[model samples]
Target: MDLIKTDQYGRQIGYVQGANIDFEVGADEADSINDFEIELKRWNWDGSIRYGTRVFSPDTEYGGIVREISTDTSTNVIRAKGDTWRGMMTKKIIQPLSGQDYATASGELNSIIKSKIEAEYPGLFYGVTADTGVTVNNYQFDRYCTLHAGLVKMLKSVGYRLDIRYQEGDVGMAGYVKVSAVPINDLSSEYELTNDNNMNFITDDNRRGINHLICLGKGDLKDRLVIHLYADQNGTISQTQQYFKGAEEIAAIYDSSGSERDDLIKNGIKELESKKSSMSYNMTMTKLEGNIDLGDIVGGKDYLTGISMKKPIGRKIWTISSGKEKVVYKLEGET
Candidate 1:
């Protein structure tokens, strides 16, 4: 008996012959043949365990970065051409704009509008940039309207009738933005809106990051109004609020304390009453805690930066004073 080898096609690719005739093995006789142990030689031309490859031309291939390359002979797999724009088939960036490849697409559109407007209306749209206003809550346009007095005058001069579509009320980072729209006659309406478009009379937890001014009326009047201060996103980052107390109250307290000094008990009661309201001055708040100082002393050149006041226990009184003269009141606690 002689051992035999077959290719993958079941055709007798190779076989060995013996000197003495013993038996011929049939494909169906599986149980009877048992004496031979087969060993393969390199002569068999079935295929290599480590496959070879053939070069493919570009004309026949269809894919990104098509090029002439080799392919795996065993599994018939083609090599990937390492082209820079491989994923461009699906995610392509096409535009006529300035700046980087992956920059914000809206910026390019804005540029187009600006350039077109400038060319069409030369000297008219001169400094026309992204303008932001204040409102109340986060909602659709129509809550509030805010316009820098200068911008309003400029737009009005150009024969454009504008209306506030929405605005950020609190005028802080977390506050809403006012929206504005204008009719452009034959052209489309200039429909602009901001994300902050809600009533901002009160503080919202989401808007704590916004540095707002609690306007206690100029000179500490009875009606203390808090105006949310929000700088333009593309403007300077002013992160402090100047606090000024009414001059009349301070003067009255000082006069009362001074006149009754002769009567010790009367002066003491007057002093206590005078101290009832916290001290007020033109101070700047830079941080949350009273420990952080951020402004200059009222009449002195001493810099007070990173100074914040902490509220007293049980009461919402945040006191910061020097040498018996109190300065700054934590209005956030009261508001």
Candidate 2:
């Protein structure tokens, strides 16, 4: 793998060669901020690489902005580490204007994101696009948080993921950031890994997961709005269960500022989704047949445990050293 250095604006600076590099890409839900590090001998440095420099891997087509650089005078080695473009969003906080408790938006996901960015930071070079066709009737960011956190929260509720990439500049143009809301791919039917295959994996069966939530909404005591949220057989959150083997109930107090029952239910559902039992699988494979990427669901089975599951690929890490690369895949959720 070759590392290419670029200016903060994405203009090509030069190639970063003869360095040991470790690059990682993460799904929106699991680890949204991808990161990388490079280590090389000080004598081999050309001094072109500095703070704010962007490093990209052509093989992975993933890049990150340099955030820190350090040196070891004793060993004459320099190391640089930074977060990917998605991390840039963390630098900006989403806050409502005067007299408003929440920063709100409606309409298509992409349009809402674009509007927010343009409204908050005019003339910003970032671009937004979406093809997931998801729209929210009412979305609110109540507390001040990083733009990345706000966007991830909004998209996760609608079954989408944030995608960030750097688009190379065209003629007479400087490269810029491109953001998108994309549907999480369900590729379980196409790819399945098992103990019999050329893959090594570990299964985590967390029995302490919450399966039911009793949500309490606005109003006073007996008059307060109430609702029950459950993770059904399919792991889908709903008000009632058609088939129930056992119940693990917990009380969840909804935001007092939210008066609508719909809002309560929505918040409860999101909470239940996260609290469910985790039967997760973490697998490492040297090669895969299909084009499997982050945010895509893949099938896994452990014959010893007789467990078969399909979960989203949450994170991927690539280590390039000694002219060899190794990749690790992490799947989120359980059977």
Candidate 3:
């Protein structure tokens, strides 16, 4: 319930009322909750403060950049605006760039985040975290478009999330941009939605029939991504046929013709299915704590629907607003 403003170096400059801070802090989208934004408003403020005077609530620990400054010198009217740390990255649209073959492993990915990306874009990353141990697969990039798009696509393809950890990072690190590889719905926390607790629960059944995917690759070998072992292609997908019948065919940027292409192909199918198959549940928790952010797993119950979700599910916070601060979450599991 507090909003503090800081200078470019994160030194406290001033503070604002909690009501003046309005933010959409959750990755509410189905699976690609890549980023979130915050907005601060004030009736009268210092216009001479200049740029880089950031503001953010201590809850997120993520600093925001003062990008927009509105002022009328004649009337002495003024206003200033800013966005969260991730907002800075989304604006950095990358151009079409091609690169030679590169090996992508858990360690290599972390190295890229720490060295290459962080070097190019300073003050964005803090450190890396536990990654699913996978083989060193040869991969290449051709026109990533943007860091956000490329990073999310690559991470989602591998059945993982490029989670943004706002608090509690590496031992020596003391800033933002701590990325982690967290599997979706790796439900680890549990919660109960009693009649008086849960505001409401909504369920959605994906009937687009995009349950299966035909992942295609590129180059002379026409390197196709292998997905049979990791995902179901013939049984569960082929069984249903109503609209957009059968499997969903998609194209991928295949750069190599090695056995390692398995990761690429598998990731492609998983990325699609992550959005295609399965039911989605959304519930409003009356109160959300600072610890409950993106990439955390929790469970809830909907007694009215008579649908008692058996297992705990991974969820992402989509929205956070003041005045009782109604928080909404998108659940990732079966109901």
Candidate 1 per-residue lDDT over residues 22-133, each given as its tens digit: 1111111112220111112233222311111111111111111212233455644333222111111112222323553322112222232344334432431222345333
Write one digit per residue (lDDT tens) for candidate 2, span 104-187: 878898887777666654543354664457799768875897787788779878887766655666644456556667777687
Question: Candidate 2, residue 274: CA error in Å?
Answer: 9.3
Q: Order of candidates by lDDT, top first? A: 2, 3, 1
Please give the lDDT score at residue 307 for candidate 2: 75
For each candidate in turn, the TM-score is 0.12, 0.74, 0.57
How many clashes (backbone N, Cα, C below 3 Å) per candidate?
Answer: 35, 0, 3
Per-candidate local distance difference test: 0.23, 0.71, 0.47
Off by over 4 Å in 1: 1-125, 128-144, 147-306, 309-335
Residue 35 shift from truth in candidate 2, angstroms: 2.5
Higher-ranked by TM-score: 1 or 2: 2
Question: How many clashes show up in model 1?
Answer: 35
Least accurate 10 contiguous residues by lDDT in model 3? 229-238
In TM-score terms, candidate 2 sits at 0.74
Write out the backbone clash pairs for model 2: none
Scored against the true structure, residue 84 in model 3 reaches a CA lDDT of: 56
2 or 3: which has the higher lDDT? 2
Q: Each model's RMSD to truth, in Å?
A: 33.2, 5.7, 9.2
